[model samples]
Target: MQQAPRPRFGIMTAPMQVGYHDVLRVWREADAIREIEHAWLFDHLMPIGGDPGGPAYEGWTMLSALAAQTQRLRVGLLVTSNRFRPPAMLAKIAATVDVVSGGRLDFGIGAGSRPSHPLARREYEAHGLPFHDAAHAVGSLAEACTVIRRLWTETEPFDFDGKYVQLTGAFCNPKPVQRPYPPILIGGRSASVLRVAAEHADVWNIPGGDLDDVVSRSALLDRYCAEIGRDPASITRSIHLPVSYDQPGVTRDAIAEAIDAGFQHLVLGLAAPYPAGVARWVTDEFIAPSTWN
Candidate 1:
């Protein structure tokens, strides 16, 4: 039998409704804390919660800055919306981040947000980005993954003519510092997205809410991987669980449950207006106790 993947813990600070300095401070603190192995930010052009018109930093640009400031923890956006940028351009941007962070980038991408999410949908219109239907989103995501990977690994310039993407003499100049390329992390819970994940993602992530639902999604992903002749165990299972300062025990229980369900990569989502020493508090209150148990 294949051994299960070892657990890894990380933190995500959603950029919405928060100041840059506050996010930076938390990440800087997490950088020094050994328990925090990775750090992430969400990709959004506008706020999804709190005051709808509140400040929201663009993910990749902020990520590059954070990468320059921090030394130890691996860094990435929890996901980049495939609809937000052209694949080749995204490939270049990600490569630059990997170089900036000395190859610590875990490149996360997905078939944008669900069309039903009003807040997520509004951003597309607000930023003059087109929000396509589900079919287009998924198809484009599949092609985007293929194009981005080739851009990173292929030596010679190449051309691509997929239904959803087109390129000519496309090439990435500064390849990521990580050999071959940085790990690709695909985040989503849809069957179509899972199929894509099975083929491309080194790590697969879903937001945590209903345990049974996520476990079922993981099993579906396993089926997808098997159909492709890939070992389901080869892909790391990542879950993003929201953290509550006043309800650490609740979060800890969720962590324990997710671990029991074979989720090896845990991303704890920290709400903004982070308290002083929040990173250390997370370590003490959640990670250490859960892992020790």
Candidate 2:
């Protein structure tokens, strides 16, 4: 039997409670490391973990800057909330980043934050955006995916009459550097979202911690893909595992488990106040040990 491909590792520096220079410093460092395959930022208008009043840099704006600053690693928001921007506008912004990075953009997106997370939910109202019900959010996301893909691939200007979104004479000029378009990585665990991923995503990502829960979620995604007559193995399985600065051993174990669970794409999330050489430290502690054949 053919051996499974080795898991590829990346880093996510959440742009919360951190300064612009600090984040730029980390991304500059990670850019030189061959072991780090991609870099990511989370999409949030406010601090979700640190002090509520602390600084939170907008994701897409910062991402464009980072794309200009880095050369190798693929870059994107860990998962952009569809509710944050209209689909056509977002498609244009993403295409610009893809061009800036010379085609290194991974379009990670989702059906916005869940209602259960009060911290994440508050951002919508604060930003003068509507916070709709979960069913509406999921339905809108599915349609957003369709509209965005068409905006990227369709040559001529077209109109979209989606239930949650509508566009007239929508067209993207100076298309993305990537042929067809940048890879779509949909991040979510809901059954409805998984069904959307089954139809649209090139990659499917979920947060790690609950291995049993994620394993079952991945299985559900496979079933959804099957229901649509798409190959279950076609969608790459990605997991976001948080890094432990003090306990590298614990992180190593999580990496080992996630790899065993068949997660081919691993994004190691780094917490704020990142230590010196954190990227290299991650490779030394978690990636190298877990990659042993």
| TM-scores, all models, native as reference | 0.98, 0.99
Clashes of 1: 0
Note each model's CA RMSD in angstroms. 1.0, 0.7
Model 2 residue 206 distance off true place after TM-score fit, in angstroms: 0.3
lDDT of 2 by residue, 1-293 (tens): 99998789999999999999899999999999988899999999998986999999999999999999999999999999999999999999999999999999999999999988999999999999999998999999999999988888999999888799989999998799898899999999999999999999999999998999999999999999999899999999999999989887888888889888999999999998999998888888887877775
Candidate 1 at residue 33, lDDT?
Answer: 97
Stretches off by above 4 angstroms in model 2 are none
CA lDDT, every prediction? 0.95, 0.94
Quote model 1's TM-score. Answer: 0.98
TM-score of candidate 2 relative to the true fold: 0.99
